[model samples]
Every structure is written in C-alpha cells, then in structure tokens.
Target: MSKATVYFGIILLLAVVIYFSLGSNFHNSTTSDLNFGTFSMKIPRYWKKIEFDGIDSYIGGITNETDSLTFDYGWYSYNLSYENREKQLFATDTINGKIALITKPKEVGNGTLGIYIEEAYKKNRFNFLGKNILDEQIVFEIFKSIRFKDSDTTLNSKSFGFTDKITPYSGRSLFYTHCASCHHRNKNLFGPAFASINELDFKKWIIDTTNLGLTGMAKFGIRYHQKAFKKLLMDNDIEKLIEYSKVST
Candidate 1:
C-alpha cells in the first residue's frame, strides 16, 4: 500500500474512535446528580428543584415539563382500592435491600404514574412521579442510581432536620419523619389531634414528654416517641414543629 493511503486509513480509524468516545459523553452529559444532603439521584439537567406544599408540603421535589421526583426522610403511605388496583400495572422490588413500588397506568402513555420507595433500614423514603412518561426503563434507571450517604454525619450537621433555618416546609418533613406515624393534625390517630393542644403545654410536651407537665392521654406519646423528644431536636426545632402542627391540617 502507498504511504499516503496508509496515513489516510490511520486517520480514519482515529476519527471513528473519537466520534464514539464523544457520543458516549454526550449521552451522559444530559443528566446530572442532584444532592439532597442525605441522598443523591441522577436527573436530567432540565429538571428544576421546587418545594411541595399542603400535606406533602415538607417534601423536596424537582420537575421538568413532564416528570417530577419528590423525596424526604420519613414515612409515606400509598393505598389503592381493589378495583382500581386491577386497572393499574404495579410491581414491588427492592433497592439496596429496601422495598420499592413502581406503578403505572394499565396502558402505556396513559394516566398518572409513580414509584414509591420505603427505605426501612435507613428511616428514609423517596418517590418519583411522571405524567405520560413513555419510557419506564429510563425512570427505573434514574431510581436505581439513587445513592444514600453512608453516614449520619451530614444529616445531623446540615439543615436536613428542623433547625434554626426551619420553615413550614422543613417542619412538614420533620412531622412526617417523627410524628405522622402516631399523630394527625385534625382527627385522632394513635395520639390526640394537634388542634386540641394549646401553645404552652404543647412546647412542654415536646421538650420533655416524660415530665410532670404532661397528663392524661398526652403522656402516652412519651413511651412511643422518646427519641423525638430526646434526639437531635433543639429548642427552635421544637418550636418550629409546634408552628407546623398548628397549620398542618
């Protein structure tokens, strides 16, 4: 072969290699990892973070034109009646040993759909929702890439919990994390309605549930939620939680 032909062939091979390498990066460049102090997840760069309101008001969420992902460190409950259950396609699986549920409308390109994850081992939960998201595999890949920070140091040190920076938003997360399992804002659950408590005694109840300041059924909360009163909460955190409870309903 002529040297000129040999040079041209080598250059052509290098061009092919470079093209493939750049193509791989271009695909990856469309997504980036979003950090939320305790965990991180891969999402499209076009997705913008927003705070949710109302009952889910404490949740930190992100969304684009068609898809949304919301998550928080706490308990989340989802229920569907038997008839409606038959109308949907749903499956349960595990993520890092934690149970997860992915639900979609019966037919593709149909109704609302979501993924609910219960991270029992870590006392945290997260979920994603999309409307008419034609590609379930793409959403699954995003959920699969979620990475939880290996330690609690960041959760404790940062604004992850109720703190001086507490807002109605963060307070809702705190309530869901610690209080929602037992207490409800309006009607009674395992505990009395938050609406019944006056401000002064409510502060006392949160600060020292085992103390003499509490009486009757209110004291019952202590045995079930000792860690809430004892662990990680500051005076301001308690105050913020109290503020949230009043407006929570």
Candidate 2:
C-alpha cells in the first residue's frame, strides 16, 4: 500500500481502539440500588455512598475536575399550601405510582431538581445537586426510578418512627423529633447546641434566626408552618421547652 493509505489505516485503528476503551469504561461502571426504608433508587456506580448514623437518609456523590454531583434522600413531611406552591416549579407529576412535587434548586442555580414524595404519613425529599454534571433530563431519569418499598417491609418497620411522624407536641418531643437530627442536647451535629443559647434566644432563634439564611442554618420556615406548629404544641409546651433548656444547660 502507498504511504498515505498506510497512515489512513493506522488512524482508523487508533480511533477504533479509543472508542472501545471508552465503551469498556462505560459498561464496567456499576449502578447501585439504594434502599432507604421509605424509598429506593438506583445510583450510578461512579457515585460513592455516604451513610449518616441516627438519621434515616442516604447521601452520595462523585466529583471530577470540572464539576461534581451529589444525591441526597431524606425523610421530610410538608403540606404544600398556595404560598408554598408558588415558589416551587409550578408542576406536579407521578413517579413510581405516587404524586411528586418538583422543585427547582435555587441554591445551586445549575438546573438541579428536587422530588418531594408523600405517602400516608411518610414523606421523603430527594435532592440532586450539580446540574453541570447531570442535567435536568438525566436527573429526572434517576428520580423516576425511585420506588417506595411496601409499608410492612420498610427498613424502619417500627411504626415509621419520629422521622415520618409530624408531632408538634411538647417542645421536648419536638426538639427530639426535628432538631435532634442536626443538633444534640449539648453537642453540635450540623448546627450549634441548644445548651449554648438561653431560652429567650433559643425561641428567637427558632422563630426568626433559623430561617434567616444564617451561616449554618437554611431557610426552614418555607417548608414548616406556624399552623402546624400550633397543632403539634400548646402554649404550655413552649414554656416547658424553655424550662427544660434552662435545667439542661
């Protein structure tokens, strides 16, 4: 064969080798099925799973040179009122035979989507971060794969427990059910401890500071409501929480 012909054949061989190499990597990448008592999802193999103790949730992610992607599934319950609906994506759809509310991620600004699913008294929120890594379409595909396990066969079969229940009753119970996940009586998990702040400051912190986009706290007021708080706790309960804090500190 002529010199040009030989060079062309060599180039073609290189292209073929590169294609199969990439194909092999893609094929070998494993996908993991994650079962979080409330729901299950299939995650790409590249992502590494991270487990949190004492919390019924799963967080996993993979990072690269240019971008990163993370997935988080946690138990959360909320009633979407008109005001709440306005801030969301203004859309609703069914995933795995359950109605799910779609919310665009305002924090990431990378087109990440959040799927909120409610079943009986159990609710869960799935958050996809890093839109640069996984676009909206891919995110939806991953989210649509989520399946709610049978109620009787869930990981937490013990009455769905505190994470799923919305008991706004005594402040002590309220603290345990909600605040305890991120905070302890005297130590800090995700945020500061209650023992550090006085009762007045603690009440003010929950009512205003917690939702003010503070350094450590996110805006929780948007998801939880005062009406629900009242339904869950009485005036006496609030006082009790304050008194308890004083004694515990």
Candidate 3:
C-alpha cells in the first residue's frame, strides 16, 4: 500500500497494457499487402516474383502448403501449361500459421501448394468504398470483376469458384469434355496456356471462351458441362489448375 509500491504497480500495469494492445501488430500480413501479383499472394519478403522461364514464378519462403514453415515455400504456380517446369505452387499456410486443411499432390510435396483466396466478394464490407473493419461478422463485398481478352475460358476455369469441389480427374474430365475440343491439356493447340491463368482470370476466361448463355463458346459449356462447370469448380480449382498447368509437358 506504500506510494513507492503503488507507483511500481502502475508502471507494470502500463507495460502490460502496451503489450496486449499490440496484439494485432502480431497479425500475419495477407499476401495482398505484398507487391506480389494477385497470382501468388502471401508471398514472403524473403522471396521475389520473377519471370522464371517465361512464366509466373516465386522463389523463397514456405513452398509446400503442408510442409512445416521453413525456407520460402518453394514456388507457387500459375496455370501456364505451355511453360514446362517443376511443381511450383502457392505457399498458402503462413511461415507461421495453422496447418492448411488442403494438402496438395505428393508431386507438390506437403506444402500448402494451392492459391489462398477468400473469394472476391460482390461487396466488401469494411472496404465498402474502400473502408476498413474490426467487425468480423459484418460482411462486406467486392464490386470487382475480371474479364479476359480471349473468349474461350469460363469462371469455372477461374480458381474453381469460391469453394468448388471438382477433383483432378473430374476437372480434367470436365476440361476435356468442354475445353479439349478447342484446347489441349499439354499444348497451346487452341488457345493459350490453360495453366498460366489466375483464378479470377480463369473464371473470366471461362466466361469469355464459353460464352455462358450468350453466343460463341457457351454452346457446349452450357449444353453438356454447364452444371458441373458452374457448381463443381471453385477457387480451390483455380489453385489446382495453377499447379496442374505447370506440370504440363
């Protein structure tokens, strides 16, 4: 109860407050914060994006999504099928975060080999007109859209949709059924690299190529692969394609 003791206690309490208030600073920075393109986000400071072999590439930071955090997650990939290389993928997990639920192909090793995207919202909450947020439940939207130059791809081709469930085989089946007629899995037979695309571009690409409900391409996409193309494909699918495109021969 002495004055000296009271003063010391105040100092201790102040220090504690300062430390706790710094909780958020401890937060992990999302990939967007970095300059890395929308393709391989969450890219680390240790790594850099470069045109390695004329394709989207990352070198450094945690590579494998499943592998324990270590050096740069190898290389994250973009669906550039024409570019022949090894298993390059997005290091989804943090150099320090939870173990990613989705484990990539063993060919990709244990690292979070998929692109980490939370679905482009129709309207971002905190960022209403570019605002910020502390409220988790108050959902915002992203009034954003990606359109492609070519008109042969679809949204399904984009990072699978927000949460698609198309497996590799099914995706391939769907692609072959709908895309192979015009495109080739391993070469630029019809269009560009099916792999080099980012999810947003991929989706937009699908819409452009297929023509959804309009004219040109959709005739087949809507006729046969419409249901699965729209439903089964999701953002994760984009992640898969990003990787799949790279392994192409």
| N/CA/C clash count, model 3 | 61
Clashing pairs in 1: none
- lDDT per residue as tens, model 2, 157-179: 11111121222233454454345
Clashing pairs in model 2, backbone N/Cα/C closer than 3 A: 168-232, 169-232
Tell me how candidate 3 scores on lDDT: 0.34
lDDT by residue for model 3 (86-185), tens: 3322212111111111122224232232322222122110101111222211111111121112212232332222222313233443354345556666
Return whichever of 2 and 3 wins on TM-score. 2
Instruction: Output the worst ten-in-a-row residue range by lDDT, candidate 2.
Output: 153-162
C-alpha lDDT (0 to 100) for residue 137 of candidate 2: 53
| Runs of candidate 1 exceeding 4 Å displacement | 1-3, 27-30, 53-57, 71-83, 119-125, 149-249
Best by TM-score: 1
In angstroms, how far off is 111's CA in candidate 2?
8.4
Q: How many backbone clashes does candidate 2 have?
A: 2
- Estimated TM-score for each candidate: 0.49, 0.39, 0.29
- The per-residue C-alpha lDDT of model 1 at residue 118 equals 56
